[model samples]
Target: MAKMPVYLTTPIYYVNDRPHIGHAYTSLATDVLARFKRLDGHEVFFLTGTDEHGQKVEKAAKDAGEDPQAFTDRVSQAFRELTATMGFSNDDFIRTTEPRHKAACVALWQALAGKGEIYLGDYEGWYAVRDEAFYGPDELTERDGVKYAPSGAPVEWVREPSYFFRLSKWLPELLRRYDLPEGHPDRIDIQPESRRNEVRAFIQQGLKDFAERPEKLDLSVSRTSFTWGVKVPGDEAHVMYVWLDALTNYITAAGYPDTAHPRWRFWPADVHFVGKDIVRFHTIYWPAFLMAAGLPVPRRVFAHGWWTNEGQKISKSLGNVIDPVALVEEFGLDPVRYFLLREVPFGNDGDFSRKALVHRLNGELADALGNLANRTLSLIQRNCEGRLPAEAVRDASDAALFASLDTLLATVRNQLDQQQFHLALESVFASVRDANGYITQQAPWALKKTDLVRMAAVLRHLHTALRAYATVLQPFMPATMAALLDQLGVPADARDFGALATPLPEGTPLPPPAPLFRKLDLPA
Candidate 1:
């Protein structure tokens, strides 16, 4: 069968700071999806990198007494290092400062300008430099003689010669696109039903408000106060808005301007994974920009929620920002990866607790799955002389266990397709728990003394189920699963979805069993 192409992306992370656990959360989720698609026989393109150009970046660079390019180059490398550190399987890592990306941004600007969707205007509003967004007066809150954006980022009044995109003109089209029913072919699928509702509400409100006051709906798409970003196509005095440049990185990595570029086939990306805070830029401004440029909009945009450290908001002042590298260094990479997705539903805010991490590490990884694998393999090694046991006449219990294994992949596929990582992991581990129960009831060890034939059949059943578990789980915990598969004597080529249909050959020699996970010591 020909491979189906699927494109997935992690929002290009801002380069103003080192990578944190939140960045890892999004990248790991995207990585797991890409790995799953590849193992399931699809051609996948996974893109992630740093968003390098913006007023905030320039200010941070100045604070450090470094040139903006040098500053971005240094911080961007940290993000690149992170992909490796986390074992991310991205096909491309694109930096906004790359020449191709800058060119693509320029072309997109020209396309919108040629369509007369862009025009010169004076931008007078309350802007939040920290957010790189504008807030209407009604959205601002006052405290102690200070004004703050809805995000609590302080705002400053600004007036500048800027370019504006005819955002209000496309409000009706955006509403139509977002309002398409759930199963509509061209529906703009914004995930976590709550987020989809939020986008819908914003659009409906914008349309209602636009009829009363149209000027307030247009978007400022260029800035005169920042010189560290993509320059306007014809107006060097202004730079494209940080968002315009940043969002274009999605298409730039897919060969935007050169539609004939081989990788351009991946355009109109299958999904763009972003944090909830930026959903407006993606679901609203991004699609409108694509429409103005006569380009295809992405099929879906999933906005996942934030993470807090020990029930407190993660902040620099709080000094509780979770460093992903440190977490992986303290706990194994796969454990951290597994804990992040398994601990919470993908779209809900979750707390990063050491107690929770240790509990999952000890209970799920070490006790449940690992103990099952070790016990089953050790029994075969000791009784069957380190060989895979041959199957005997099956029983009703055997039939029931295989029934669940048969449907495992389909069940996981449904959950993952909707970005439900927690549910998918739950499904996989549910089988693990079942297998554990099967072994306890069968007592294969005691059966070895009385009914050798039944013992062999019981061992073979477990081996078959373990192969299925490891095959499906390789995406979430690659290194650990690879080791597990190796211990089972599974050929490296036989690790994909296709191999699940062909069980391990009976009597094949297996390696000595080794424990996959060690119980973590609890903190005092």
Candidate 2:
């Protein structure tokens, strides 16, 4: 059977704020999936970029005394720099203001308008400029002597002339479409039935039309009033709304408005990874726009939860924000990747604590996996004269070891396919722990002098096992695995899952090995 094409995306980070751990988390998750899909033999397309146009960005640019474009360009480069530092292999980096993206957005807007799906009207509602969101009064709540939306954005009343999408018409269809049979790709992140029923009941009671407004509202302002967004096709009176402009990037990155391009084949995205805070924009408004334009809806919108630091929300004032680059430089990238994935279950809120990070890194990464590699390679160096042994007969111990690897690989592959990355990493580490125990029990060292030939064979098998182990770890720990493979003398391109269960020849000279991880000390 032909392998299915897998397209993955991380929600583009807004460039108004400096890159943070939250941005890193989303991109890393997408990178993990892209690597896994490629290893699974799928043609994968991965995309990540910065969302550069919005009111927040305009305000930020004004505060910095720079053009919004110039401000975004600098910050966007910072985000791009992160991909290389974090070892990401995204296929493309798209920005909202690019000519191709602007054309695509204009075309999509025209498509939706031509279909009688958009109508100009007066829009009066509570708009949160900070959130770049428009909200209904019912969704407002008092907090700290001020009204705020659930997303923590302050809301204010406003009335403006806006173009409205016929969202109310599709409420039933949206709910029904998500009501597909179990095991469907989209069913993975469908709202709970109770919540769905509540939404449905609310819609049944009465549904309101949704108006799309430009990032900067028009108030007979001069042409130079707002200079931060895509020009509104022919009408210079307005620029595209940030939500509309940002959302079109998914298609724009894939050669939108040009079906001749190869990426157009995957135009309707397979999955969108977004924070739950924007679920309404992704699940509700995005689909409505696509449907209005006679375009296919995205397959799924999986909303992941946010992270807090040490039980408190990460805030600049609180000084609890986690800097991803700082963490990567200090702990090394792989350990940070391993801890973040293994420390929390996907789709759930997680706390980033130095203690939790240290415990996992020390216990799982350093003690379990790092020690296992060090011990095995040290044995081979001392006993086998630093050479891998030839494959030997299927002894009971060897058979058991191979059997365990087969099972673990199977489970790891399955968990990765399901996006249960924590479970997948756990499964692989469990195998490492087991391998460590097996080595200690077999005491390959004890047989070194008395049974030197058998020792050679055993060390050879262990060396081969480590190669396989490192291959499985490449996605989550690319730098470390590359180093591990270098020590094993495996060719650079030979470090994939397919090389498992195959042993390099005996007498293959091994490179000098170094410690994969160092025990980190807590700062005083």
Candidate 3:
């Protein structure tokens, strides 16, 4: 059967802030999904980029004493550079300021206007410029006679002429699409069931207002107060609201307006991986905008939680934000990636601490996985020549060691499908633990002294186990796993899931083994 194309995206991050752990976490998760899809033989397009336009960008440009375009260019490049710095394989990095995005946003505005879903209106509400969102009075917290958003950003009353979308008009349709027949081909999937329920409850309460009449909120889609965004179509005085323009980046990546463009083949994204704070935007506002433009909504919007540092909220004020680049520099990129996903459940908030990272590095990656590979390769080189030895199944103990590799591929594939990255990795490293223990009991080195036949059989089984381990671990620890696979003498193209099913050819010449993960010797 032909594999269906898998299209996934991370929210285009705000350029006003430097890329940090939150940014890295989302992109890393998205990268893992994309890599797994490619390994599973699916056509994949992974989109990530900067949300470069907003009142915030304008202010930031002024603060930097640079042109808005120059400011956006510098900051957006930081985000684009993050993909390389973090070892991500994202296919496209889009900026809202790009001409392609501008055209796409304009096309969407025209579509909504032509459908009579847009209207000129005055927006009178508290706006959180940090979030690029308008919030109702109830959503704000009163403290010290000041109002702050749930995210703790200060909010201010802003009344301006804006373009509004009839967002509430599509609520019923959004609700209808929420629950379809199980496994229905066209059904939209929202992951982590908790988020879907939350959004559903919010919309249902709003629907009570519509129970008296069709609900229409006149959503502000454009703002006259900002000059950094795409100009509202035919209304040069106003710029498109950052949310509308940023959300349109998804369709822009899909070749919107130019619907015939080949890039449009990946329309209606398979998933939009976003932070929990923005679930309302990606799930509610984004879909309503698409529906207004007569376009298909994305299939899934999976919201993930945040990261805290030592039980404190990750904040610029506290100087507690974790810099992913620094983490990669201090530790190997692959180890940091492995630790983040492995340390926490995918949907839950994670805590970052130097101690925890080092523990996982030394324990999980270094001891369990890294030591096992190094030990096996060293024994094979020392005991049985430098080439892989043919096995003779003379002892029951020889086969017990390779048993862990038997169901690993299927187990990992199902976990990845469910987005249980930590579980998937835990399963692999669990086998690694078992393999380490198995080797200790079998004592391949001792077997060499007594029975060379059993020793060769044990070594071959060890090599086979490592091959499976390396192949499945590629998505999480690509660089380290690639080096490990290289040491195992597996050919480049053949390093994939299919190769996992096949046995490593006996007598394959192996490269000298080296430590896969180095221990961190932190200073006291």
Best by TM-score: 1
Question: What stretches of model 1 exceed 4 Å from their correct place?
Answer: 391-393
What are the models' TM-scores?
Answer: 0.98, 0.91, 0.96
- What is candidate 1's TM-score against the reference? 0.98
lDDT of 3 by residue, 10-47 (tens): 99999886899999999999999899889878899999
Estimate, for each residue in 79-150, the C-alpha lDDT of model 1 and write its tens digit: 999999999999999999999999999999999999999999899989999999999787899999889999
Model 2 lDDT-worst window of ten: 215-224
What's the best-to-worst order under TM-score? 1, 3, 2
How does model 1 fare in lDDT? 0.92
Candidate achieving higher lDDT, 2 or 3? 3
Error of 2 at 162 (Å): 0.6
The TM-score between candidate 2 and the true structure equals: 0.91
Of 1 and 3, the candidate ahead on TM-score is 1
Better of 1 and 3 by lDDT: 1
